[model samples]
Target: MQQPLAPWLEPTLNKLLAQAHEGQLAHALLLPLSKEQGAEVLLNRLLQGLLCLNGNACGQCKSCHLLAAGTHPDAYSIKADGNQIKVDQIRELTSALSKTAQQGGARVAIIWQAEQLNHAAANALLKTLEEPAANCFIVLASAKAGLLPATIRSRCQNVALTQVSKAQSRDWLQNQGVDWNTVGWTYDVLGGPYAMLQQQGQERLEQLQSARKEWSNALAKGQVSATLCQYTQDQPADSLHVLHWLISKKMGSILASQRAFANRLSALISEISQVRQQLAHMPSVNYVALCTRLVLDYQQAAKQ
Candidate 1:
């Protein structure tokens, strides 16, 4: 067999290979792995092995070398640039799938963050999944499997990559020469082996932490509306956390919960959903403005 790539994924790799070896593999494989779980690396390696001409997982084969060089003709990958995976991209992939494999073997297509597909794109891809070509494989990787269509999910073999032990991850990082001081919270932030080695700038993490703190303080001060809006706008991505924090704080005040805090939390949660819906429609919305409004509204509701 070809030398194992990503020894950490050897078990999963072996399981998949055994299926392939038995000629009982499914056309679609849904790998629901977290961002830091090294899902992408596993996806690439799996495709490489499938495409290897020797049918033996040989990394030294001509096809394997092409994959290492990032020039594999039969392997394709798609990822969202900013927003959703557009219908055109899926259409193109579907058309490409119709053609015979360049290596005259397996045709592999991978979609990163596949759940980011918009309604139209999802529909476009559904047709292909329903009637895939012979010797073709589709891999969809996402952190949130709930976001994908149930129909699509039901058709694939779902493989969830769970969190590895923190001690094991830390040990692996040390072996990789990661500087813990400079990379403080990297483990908590990235969550695994695939994400540990990534270099993040000191300032960005600090800025996000500062924003979270400031937002927390403002909520405690009973600031509602405009000020809350400002905080939300400044940290749009953290909107979910901000709302959750408010709910947690209010939960302690049973009297407050009885008074009106519960209603406020409910309303804020609804508003948060609306904000996400709006963002899905118009991604260019002012993040600061949106977040500020949400925070302020929740603050006002809590006081009642």
Candidate 2:
């Protein structure tokens, strides 16, 4: 079920709902891709509104109940099955759209991490986006929209969202009774409280911090390969994200550090980015070995 929109996003929601009410809503709506915003919740809110019977989503209608149960015959979600949204998934969605909605109402599809659509998958989906099905609405949101094909992006109506101010985020967190340090770290690491809490919770703070420090020490000591192999060789999918977040968190400061440090960190970040792309797009990836190899490559490149 979709949660209520945050105060900061209510305006955007209202604007879209207005368009929807007017029958002028685009078949595809591209929400903010930034981590600072919860685009999914916004999209869900819009979908709930569309499904509501009384124009106002009282959370008491049959459609609302179905949505809450995730059995909304008309609503579907497309997200990463493993690491990518494959062509088959897109095809399934298309087929589903071609049929009349089970409830004989609108057809809605939410594409989470739309940027992760593989080339073939994206191409296949592009045709549908360009020539939308009747009463079909697609919502695509991603922090890495830049990675999506220009053509696919062009077909959607963009919903612009600005980052929430720090003061506002702080107040929100305080109201929620989040401790000061977590609020601070969440802001620093994840860009805002909402993203931070979603990405990392209080229970994970200590372990994540320890992991980050160990990786940093390894990076500094030129032990990248060994460090990655030790911690990531068994579960690279999970390990790599933790490692990546740690490195990503420090990249800004690294870029501003001394010349040698900046050069090395830049090289390391590049290697991480390349491997991350491969992990996302390629099938049958040896996640553990790939991460280890990338770390080794980063070490060599960083030395240059």
Candidate 3:
């Protein structure tokens, strides 16, 4: 079933629906999700609106029924298999798109995490995006659009989802009875309350707090190995995000003598950013080694 759209997103949806009504809807779209937004949720909502008999995705029509059942002939989705979206996937999609809609209604295709598309895959898909099928809407969504190939991006209209105010996000989450402890770290990874809701539980909250403290103490005492050891394969990305946010936040508290290390700090930030990219996009990486090297590098840089 389609979920309710976030309030902050309503305005954006309204604008797009208006364009859709006016017959100005672009066949191809590149949407970069706001930090902390659910990429899947946004994609589904957009697809719902596109496929919905009514502009609002009323969820009671034949189209909505097919969509909910995952058997909609005109509805298509492309997602990463493991870490990459292969060329074959794009080929299959393009082939299917060439055909007429089975239900004789609007057709919609959404590529989630489009940055995961490999070179061949992106190029293959770019051709179709340049001249998409009539009555078909293709939406490409990613957390970072820059990671996608320039050619593929050039052919799509861009829609960047911006973050709502922290206060507004807090109120919304509260209304949902969400139990996101700290509430602030909900902003980590550009995630919002809905994302943090997945991490609820006093036990999980305590674990996160302990990890954050460990990260802080490790940096202070130069316990790089021990801190790096804390990162598990199951949640390496989340752990790294917390540590990065913590380190960045504590950078301002450096001693006056360490103020001259600003350049080094900036460099470490860039390195952390690169590491994040690696952890997210590269498959089969030894995260332990990567985390250890990154933390030790930051320590050495801070001392210099």
How high is each candidate's TM-score? 0.64, 0.68, 0.75
True lDDT of residue 171, candidate 1: 69
Error of 1 at 66 (Å): 1.9
Return the number of clashes found in candidate 1: 12
Candidate 1 lDDT, 131-169, residue by residue in tens: 978889999988788899999898898875645776666
- Stretches off by above 4 angstroms in model 3 are 1-4, 33-35, 81-83, 179-181, 202-206, 216-228, 231-234, 247-304
Better of 2 and 3 by TM-score: 3
**Who is ahead in lDDT, 1 or 2?**
2
Candidate that scores best on TM-score: 3
Q: Write model 3 residue lDDT over 131-235, tens digit each, in one string.
A: 888888988888788998888888888876656777887777777676445555746653676566555565655556766776677677766554446554556
Error of 1 at 233 (Å): 11
Instruction: Identify the superior model by TM-score, candidate 1 or candidate 3.
Output: 3
RMSD of each: 6.4, 5.7, 4.4
Which candidate wins on lDDT? 3
Clashes of each: 12, 2, 3
Flag regions of model 1 displaced more than 4 Å: 1-8, 179-185, 200-304
Task: Write model 2 residue lDDT over 95-182, tens digit each, in one string.
Answer: 9988998776678888889999998999999999978987789888787888889999899998888567777776776666666564
lDDT of each: 0.71, 0.72, 0.75
